[model samples]
Target chain A: MDDPRPTSGPVPPRRPSGRLEESKGPLVEPSAGASASGPHEQPGLGHLLANCEGQELQPGLHAALEVCRPNTADLDDPALAEVQAALAADAGLRRRLASLQQFDQALVAALRDVRAPAGLEDRLLKAVSALAHSEGVEPLVEVEAALLAPSSDAASASCVPPASAEADHAACRDEAGYTSVRSGCLAPDTVLPSKRRAMRLSSRPMVLAASLVLVVGAGLVIWQYRRPASLPTPQQLANEATGQFQQDLSEGDGMPASKKWPAQVPASFPQLRLPQGTKWRTCRLVNVSAVMFDVTQAGVKGALYVVRAREVARGAQVPNTPSRVVFTQGVSRTMWRQGDYLCVLIVEGDEQALRRLLRPVPPVT
Target chain B: MVQDKPQDGIAELVARYHRELFAYAYRLTGRAADAEDLTQQTFLAACAAYHSLRDARCARGWLYAILRSQYLKQFSRARRLVINEDPTELEQIPEELPYEPDFDQELLQQALDRLPAEFKVVVLMFYFEGCSYKEIAEQLKLPPGTVMSRLARAKQRLRDALLHTGQPAFNGSMEAGVPQVVREGTPHVGG
Candidate 1:
């Protein structure tokens, strides 16, 4: 994929002109009475300056001290003691340490001042909400219902005020009310008010049970009667999957090379085998649960998507078949069935690289 | 329902760390738009993997790890990517700093912008994030000595830029050229 965004700003690169020490005129001049004798005798960093005697400060020793000064609290090296000694003996060294600390404070302040863009939190919430809605809205709805459902065990209810559990259930009821009010603080777009109302109405045990049965029955009926006609075409499935892959690539950013494939992926699914190490995460494409693997090989990147063969459109072809490749939007894509799993490979290169990426396709079990 | 919802935890996490994380991302990416994108991606990844977070206290570090990971993946192969492996090939540091060492933050950032990603990550995690050398070493999977080495080298460059030169002074090539497409995120589907 090509990057339209600039990695950095318009700052022109500058060449460092002089040596670090030369830019600064000089170190602290030694005190008239100071001597390089010892800390107990001299009592200030001026004694160390007396040692420098106008020659360049020892870079090796100074470099070692630089590492210790900022991290004195965390470091346990014997060198830390030397840094401490230098600090204790020289008021100059102590002042330098203080300056570094102050600089650190300023750094944290400056960086922290780079606040998140306005509405970032709102955007994040909406993105997560959309993902949750597609992956499964029922779970969130059920959670809302469970929160509102009255409990006979009020005394044992987790939300009951610690002071006492009311036999009248008023405390538990009030707590639940507070909980609902708090949930209302979610972003405006997170959960619709009408949906919350529906969930609340279904909080009754009988109502919830009936709704569950009806939902299951309706789902089965759709699968039996409506799905065959509704299945998307091979092209449609590929386009949708590709769109999703691109969206994920754009939004998901990049995967860490060391990140392991999520263990949550069920064992029943086929494992992705690519010459390049891959990281897998669960995703929804074409309304079906699938695993998306972020693949990279020889510095080229691509995505390999695996989903159940039964889930893609009939035109996707059930059962094993030869991989078919096509090019779209300057990328190469291919789809084929291996056992019960359907695989789609997308990359920016020619058919050879795309095929190369999917090499040694594990003998279909 | 009886307990705090997972979303609640995520909301709290976002509220606490989003700004800090965005700043870190900005420093890493050297651009606001890319930083915003990286921050959003970090949170999305965080939400997806929220369950793996065993301790709430570790969320800050965990989120940072994710952001850095995303940054590396996105830019590791970019033309500007560079790593100075010789830790001992030291840049000269000022013998003494002004009592305050105060300088323009943008200049400091510009200096930071000049560093290779490897050195840049270390410097930010240490100074900006206030991560201990140990914490940085553990997070980046490098030896503590290496962390100190990178931090020391980076600090010298920054100190030179901020205190001595009064402007950014590091030398590096600009991006060779923009990719034809956002190479990292490209995907296509064809019949």
Candidate 2:
């Protein structure tokens, strides 16, 4: 077969200074006084002449040189078919590729020694086990049992009317193995089936009336004394949002695409750049009208919540710059309003770390 | 087969990818303890959120994304702010260096550590993880062009570091002068 490769070109003379100059063409001359023993050096100019045979094979050579070995698919690319063909036909190009491959192999080999510490796998397994235990799906029986359990508070007990004797008997018999409460009206040892049933039926209405008044009185007292369900604080809201976002990600819903704030919104939100090593995980529309961005750094998790000023509670004060709000142990919330969005960042760390995580937002011009 | 059971699936994932994830974590954090923690957290988070993983094929990238995210969340506060080198200065690096096949692993690590985070990540994902430019770009949420440029620049810096290994100018910790650079710039946060 006729050799499709370009014919070998003349070699440039070796520099006398013993320093190699950058070669403009594929025909490179060995530096003067270069060690003959080195693997990269060729024996003579004949080898150099053998390598570069075409009009400016330098581009192809350079392109082939830039290709990483793992990107092997690129070698087959039609756009690089000429380069690939040349590489196959030319011994010198083949040698250079081989040398680069060797370099990559050596680099990989060097890095291969940095393995995970012993027992890391075990520790990780334990963590997974712990997580499983915490988040495992509850069995139906356990869920049902929890639902059936009577209120422990004495006040609540007064509010709950006693079950009918026959109903209690059926429940006790059916759930004998698991039932914690039998209706208080029936004793387990009572054997007078019909006669006791008649007496229980006769006393049921009076007992029910007395129970109703006690329930009503207890309800009134409890209602008067009970504290109103307080609204979730901003910190709590942030925590909930983070949890939901993670849940969404894990469930394969993926993150919602980030959209710019609506034009009608009056406030300018800070375009805070995340610190190095931190990445944008996902942005979600949350709380009906807010945007939540969940970000993670070095195993630490944080979330940024952006809500409109109108959406925020009336008289709610959000700082214009990052300010630390310690919500609970091991978590901190940072809140600031920029533009129309009340931005809050909830992170799992101390206040100092939270402050560091919340880089100062540049003013919107 | 284990994928049918969530716990078993997580265990399988941990068993398979822990070492690779840990190695990447070590490269990113440059500390064994932090790397271990990052790996552990990734798996735990995976376990907790595995229910949401709709595609089994995406498990590897998802794990990696989690690990990277966790690393960022944990260490963002501690990261030393670095002024990126001017593109012109980076372009001045020699295109090629004399091939030295016998370099120490520690020396290579030191060189890798000296690279900026963005560049280092691309290099690690490309060379060590065998990720293609597109894969790396997807993982890091960067444009493929940016990933390629970063990889190219990183390789040049590594070559330079390797060629100049014995000099004190490049030796010692690259982190020592970081505080000064950080002090010079106002920290801005957004992503």
Task: Enumerate the chain B TM-scores of all models.
Answer: 0.76, 0.72
lDDT of 1: 0.51
The regions of model 1 sitting more than 4 angstroms off are A1-60, A69-72, A75-79, A85-95, A136-365, B1-4, B79-91, B164-191
DockQ of predicted candidate 1: 0.08
Question: After best superposition, candidate 2 residue B84: deviation in angstroms?
Answer: 6.5
- The sequence of per-residue lDDT tens digits that candidate 2 reaches over residues A48-98 is 223333435633244234444532455665545666776666655544444
After superposing candidate 2, which stretches have Cα over 4 Å from the reference?
Answer: A1-64, A78-95, A135-365, B54-58, B76-100, B167-191
Looking at model 1, residue B130 earns an lDDT score of 61
Say which docking band candidate 1 falls in.
incorrect
